[model samples]
Target: MSKTVRIPRRSRAGILAAIILGICLLLLLTVGVLTVGAADAHPPRLVDNAGLLSQAEADSLRATLDQYSEELNFDIVVVTTNTLDGKTPRDYADDYFDYNGYGYGANRDGALFLRYINGSSKEVWLSTSGEGIKAIRDADIESIFDDMEDDIRANRYGAAFQIFAQDVRDEVLDYRSYDTIWIFVGLAVGLGVGLIATNAMRSSLKSVRQQRYAGSYIKGNSVNITEARDIFLYRTVSRVAKPKESSGGGSSTHTSSSGRSHGGGGRSM
Candidate 1:
């Protein structure tokens, strides 16, 4: 008799290949999504307009300039500074910057640089990136001028400061909220890809195990019947019961013993 052989399952390399393949598929899908991906970030960058400062803000500065110029022949240049220089402006329509002086659609910290086009010999320059006028006030444009005047009169720059701390503070706040959202989205994508790889590897490993014992193993829902023996059932021929008859003139009789018996081939007496 021919013996039945067990089927061999797949190997580790095979399973590893499957998992790697699944990961590659996921990465390909990610690439496709990127081609058409929408915003999935914090503070919900889902809108077309993000991080855009208000027109009123620029106008307010303009108003301040106009107020400052109330009967003078000077020009007020209100350029929205590019503080973070983030990839996109915070808003749909805002100031921009080019090779020349700052233009519309540019995003930057709140700042106001002031100088006399043709007036003060004692020039006052003010620039800030504050959230509001309160923050602007903290930069103390008025005080800086006052101090500069005093220092010049005394022939000493004891009040000299080339940079302002308030601009950094303002820019940090604006970019902080947006940058965090971008980071969160990136992390989520990476995590999802990892989970897909893990599950695919587990599935491929199970497939390999099943291939190892395909012919002999009776795979139940969750468990495999590995140790079951193959049984060949045979049957000993059953004997037929014989009929009994009285001691008469024309009758035959027989008795059954163990597994042997007589049949109806005998003739009557």
Candidate 2:
């Protein structure tokens, strides 16, 4: 004959608690690993190689960039370099954005503001990627440069860059709004066409006639109604003006040295 041994209630509770704790720890570890992997995917946003900004200024600008980038889901980067390593300003700016993992999504949606300093002369380039190509038009790029020109010429690099970041954010937002409006217009047009087609089809059925009462289509006692009334909730009114014609075009794109397409423009300062 054999005797069965039983575990104490306290011991059993302790074992169950330990197992739960282990599972929680494992989940936390997995989450931590994923977070680190995601962070590692994107490179630094501000690279002051020429050391144009003081530490305090760099920190403040970085915070601004990070805030806008997160809100817009687009990367906005700034780089200051003493040399382009023998490459043209355009090529250098494009390569740096592409190779350094500066973009946000798979198509790498982002924009880079490069300020290249060579002795007494300075050159600035704006490189855009992915949706950025659509958002930052040629006119918008010129406007950005125009806004920054005075500060840049006065050796206020920090102020100029701040303007660059803010202008890029505004342009992206405006483009998105414009695109959304077109989408809604398309949807409205489609709905109207569908309604017209459906009405035409219904009109072809001569046997069907308009019902004078709602109960005509319902089975007796199937639905009960004590009282009913139609209520007007709201109304919408829209007015649009004729769009003015302009000579300027949208963003112009070119293939970068890395075989990736980029939209950008550069100016000597």
Candidate 3:
């Protein structure tokens, strides 16, 4: 003989509610872990080591860099340090980018804008890797420095960084615009226009009138399709990525002190 033990309705309901609550809690925990991992995936774009800019300025600059980096597929970083800590400006910039986990792709494509503000040794340096190196040339970097060195020397850090960001964006865009597809497209369009114009001039000597509809000049009785149906065979959608422009060995580069290859230029402000 065995006793029949049964759970009450209220007890069963409480157990079910507890189980549902437990599942929900587990789901929330899982989502939280994923969120943290995603947030940790990327390093910050703007690191004001020397605290040159105010909080608002840093925030604004960081937002701009973030937007451009995503749009261009290359990280744009800016760092300001009081001193190089005994490293050359180039080495400091390169190592900072390499060690801090910046860059976008396998070659760690990124550009670093460094401002060293040590007394009597104020300097500006640009370090580029991968696509950034291909897009920004030494001469272009020098031109950027020339345009903003005065502001940097004047301790207008905010203004200088803004100018740097704008100039770099322009340079990268200009370089990427030189893809071969653009040239071929331009030539094709020009030839097509010329042919169309010549043909139109020749046709002007003949008689032709623009017809609005296919049935306008047709006899209705000649067409005798009694039934019509459209059958859908398939649907196809195609996508073509923009072609990446070749560097063509334009930019000069060298191995940084960190043993990573980089292209850039620097000058004392």
User: Which candidate ranks first by lDDT, i.e. highest?
Assistant: 2
Better of 1 and 3 by lDDT: 3
Candidate order by lDDT, decreasing, is 2, 3, 1
lDDT of 1: 0.36
Put down candidate 1 lDDT per residue, 1-269, tens digits, no spaces: 99997545667678888999999999999987876664221111011122122454334444444433222212122332223244222110121211122211222223333222122232334433212222234324444454445533453321222122223233334455666887999899999999999999998887455456565566567775679887989969989989875423321222222211111111000
At residue 135, candidate 2 shows an lDDT of 94
How much lDDT does candidate 2 score? 0.91
- TM-score pick, better of 1 and 2: 2
Best by TM-score: 2
Could you give candidate 2's per-residue lDDT for residues 1-269 as a string of tens digits?
Answer: 99999999999999999999999999999999999999766677899999989888899899889989989999999999999999999999999999887887788999999999979768999999999999998888999999999998898888888999999999989989999999999999999999999999998987989899987988888887899999999999999999864436877788998899999998998
Q: Which parts of model 3 are misplaced by more than 4 Å? A: 1-5, 8-21, 180-249
The candidate with the higher TM-score, 2 or 3, is 2
State residue 163's C-alpha deviation in candidate 3, in Å: 0.9
Model 1 weakest lDDT span, ten residues long: 260-269
Q: What is the lDDT of residue 173 in candidate 1?
A: 49
How does each model score on TM-score?
Answer: 0.20, 0.70, 0.68
